[model samples]
Target: MKNLTDKEFEQVIFENQLLILKICSIYCESQADKDDLFQEIMINLWKGLRSYRGESKLSTWIYRVGLNTAISGFKKRKRSPFIQTEELPEHSIDPKLQANQNEEVKILYHAISMLKPIDKAIALLYLEERKYDEIAEIIGISEKNVSVRIVRLKKKLEQIITKQLGG
Candidate 1:
């Protein structure tokens, strides 16, 4: 497979930025941290592009690289404070519509944030509707293990949301 030229790389990242951000959101608690993780994922993706051999779908490769970078960032974060010179700029998709959905999404993300790193990755992939085989491939786990973990994770999320809502 040919390496992506700089423009091609930029376009790919732009098209898939939301996927990267979703993974980041699962792993990061703060908007500032999500923004930082997104940038780091893009940098890592660019660097990893050269090593692409078309062994898996491009999206799978992106997921592997992004998740690995975020997990690495988690380790680095323990030793140093995250520094930010400016606050993340906010964008509203639709005021009323977003306001209604935001609370539920926020609660779900909070619950996901409580998961272990690998569990968080698994859950995010499941939520993204990735097939079992694809999730297994990306996570380097057996398909059956992915199934079992996702079952347990779903129950865990139910418990978390129930507790959060005092149900």
Candidate 2:
């Protein structure tokens, strides 16, 4: 049928998978957590698409819905039972910089982990190269707010990183 179950929906999902995956990777604490977050995003998008009128660009709607999915997903994951290290994936990084790469990424993610959910979304989207307007639109905040939050978030991230580095 030309309704909820169709190809166009899949197209939208496939097209946006990278954005969804990136958001999950940035927000989630671990690989299994990331996968759960991604699923939550997809389910929300699928559920929300039915009511998407033409008032907004499809990309805009996707951004909004996806961002909300991530925010709520992060919250749920926080309250739920989480996996221990044994549940983590064993994906390998580059051997040349393996030592430093994993440590730096873990540190970076740990720093990001400390942000409030909304600020986490803002910082993650900022890191994903979204324009200020797009970030604001996705976040339901003003452009100026996006900028301010980012500056504050950067300082917070710096503090976290500094502490992690034992400074």
Write down the lDDT of every candidate, Cα atoms only.
0.84, 0.75
- TM-score for all predictions? 0.86, 0.72
lDDT of 2 by residue, 43-153 (tens): 888887777775767766776777787776567656767733234344522346535667667788888877777887888878778788988888887999889988888
| Whole-model lDDT, model 1 | 0.84
Pairs of residues at least 3 apart in sequence or in different chains that clash in candidate 1: none
Best by lDDT: 1
Best by TM-score: 1
Instruction: Give a tens-digit lDDT track for model 1, residues 39-140.
Output: 788988888788889999989999999999888675585466775445656661244753676766878988998999999999999999999999999999
Error of 1 at 42 (Å): 0.7
Model 2 spans with C-alpha error above 4 angstroms: 1-5, 73-102, 162-167
Q: Per-residue error at 140 for model 2, in Å?
A: 1.8
Q: How accurate is candidate 2 locally (lDDT)?
A: 0.75
